[model samples]
Target: MKKINLKTTIIILSLIIISILFINNLRINKADNLSKAIVLKTNNSNVISSGVTNIGHQILTVKVLEGGHTDSKLKASNHFTGTAEIDNYYQEGDEILISIKEKQGKVTAVKAVDLYRQHWELLLFGLFVLILILYAGYTGLRALFSFVASVYIIWNILIPGLLAGQNPLLLSSFVLVLLTGIIIFSIAGFTRKGLAALAGTLSGLFITIVITIVFGNNMGLRGMTAPFSQTLLFSGHIDLNMKHIFYASIIIGASGAAMDIAMDIAASMEEIKLKKPDIEMKELIQSGFNVGRAVIGTMTTTLLLAYSGGYLTLLMLFVSKNTSLRRIINFKMVSAEILRTLTGSIGLVLVAPITALFAGWIYCSDFFIITWLKDLKSHLKFLRP
Candidate 1:
């Protein structure tokens, strides 16, 4: 006669969804030609440096260790592009990605494309999981599940929708809401705390989208400012609306940071409510506000640092050129980034109060008796009589 826990049921359902996504992705993205191989011998006699460029080729004797070409040995060629960044010089015993050309049930040719880096990546990921689990125990497992769920949802749902030329606004909106629910609920469970975080996140995302549209439309900024945007435009999707996608990017990027703020406030207020059931609505709201204030300063800076960190080289290039502040801000690339950083930070700032208010109304007020609110109300009434 044991009652099944609702939280456990939700987690199980989420796991099922993730599994489906994983399997479907494998089916759809199956690349039979790409396989892992290990270098057995290297003939680098052709490789040489010529006028600030690497002019040469690498011939590698390799054995296929994975995929359809397992246990096959072949001579693979690694051509040098003369650019340091594009070249991959392999030593003996280096694992690499090989593209196998098969014709009529026989391997025609094999070429080394890049390094087979999944081994090290998996090792690093395992280390992260071990540290997380050791530090936080069960909560860490929940966090890891949420992380994987987010990745699968993005890879399976969002990217495909965008590539299919679906309305960026609609797709982004749907994805934002979906991710918010999955991430917050997976961690906090189906509780008022999760509701508060979800509501606050969506509300802030709306603001971000509106601000992005208003500013993005009039900023005289083209969608080409986005990295690799030119390549995409000429990829036969000329009719695709890059401007709207740019706008979507702003909101989508801000949402994750905003959700963190919302969840922090909501969780803090929930703990407060549990510890002091007799607390007034105003007092609880104020406490939530206090918690928000404590975190907001550092969070905004963290957001700025995160966005800026990616373009450090570009910023240094600007600085090295003695680019005037006036001209620097006027640059389209810099301007677009300015808007993105500020808009995202604004969303973070707004979600704090929004989450606190929602947590207050949901936890302290009697008018909101959805689900567990009734049980909470048996002893604690948030409304002032």
Candidate 2:
């Protein structure tokens, strides 16, 4: 009862702290530089025609609904550019996001950036939460809290901190550690199992960090391999280490798989201990190793499939071009994907033994073993009579 109460109190306090931090961060990053707009009309239907490989641009007339030009609803003309496959064609009553420029407290210019689809996004998110709650019950609520906390930390804390020129490796590692502790303890409760899992998870994360740093350097990659990262370097008020960010991403990506294996080993060991209180330490450790082996098989395959799925189009393109297999394997993007998947899978494999050791020490008590042995001796003597 005491343990349960303590866990409950900690969870409540965590939620409160997270709520306060989220609101504060939201205020700090408020969207004051942009105005909400509704597309009134396209004043010029003529688009600047570009080559077949390029997208055309258009001009839009919009009514400013928010910002310094609030409530006036004056028509403003702006340039429009579509992103990826989405056309920047705005029809009547289509709400959109507009970047406004101000000079002398008056709106000088407006540019259409994208559409505002907050309502649809919220509906989808709500449905996801509903499904989780229905399937997992109270545990689902805990998982939901952890998921939201993680997203908030990534968006508000990690991204902002990186933009502020903080060291990506250090900041990211700190956040990963913080998140690992919160998630494991929240779901596993304040028990030996949680503690064991936490230890194993942290160890696995540390291993990943070291491996990424060492191998990332040897790969002769500068992290500019990301298409948008180069553009970001030219765009803003931030100086970032692209390579370090890449390394940090590798570590963070692997942390989830590591934590999963750790928790699984811890839970299985605890269950074994519960069913056989007198189970020897060696036997308990062996049971954990058995569980780890079973999980690692499917988990590694999952990593391979997930990493490959993202690059299916690229693979298809290579096939169409009749690119040699050696060239495709030597490609930078392909190598990076390989590095990420293998490193993460290795971390998952390591977490098993580490967690098994911790759980064995926690759940296997010498007192229980002694009692079981004494009972067995008495039974043997009585059977002789």
- Distance (Å) between predicted and true CA of 377, model 1? 14
Over 133-249, each residue of candidate 1 has an lDDT whose tens digit, in order, gives 799865776787788888887888888898889999999999989988878876776678888999898998898888888888889776778877887879887877888888888
lDDT of 2 by residue, 99-157 (tens): 87779887776667678887799899889989998999667767777887898789888
Lowest summed lDDT across 10 adjacent residues in model 2 is found at 376-385
Q: How accurate is candidate 2 locally (lDDT)?
A: 0.78
> Any runs in candidate 2 off by more than 4 Å, and if so which?
1-24, 49-56, 65-87, 236-239, 365-385
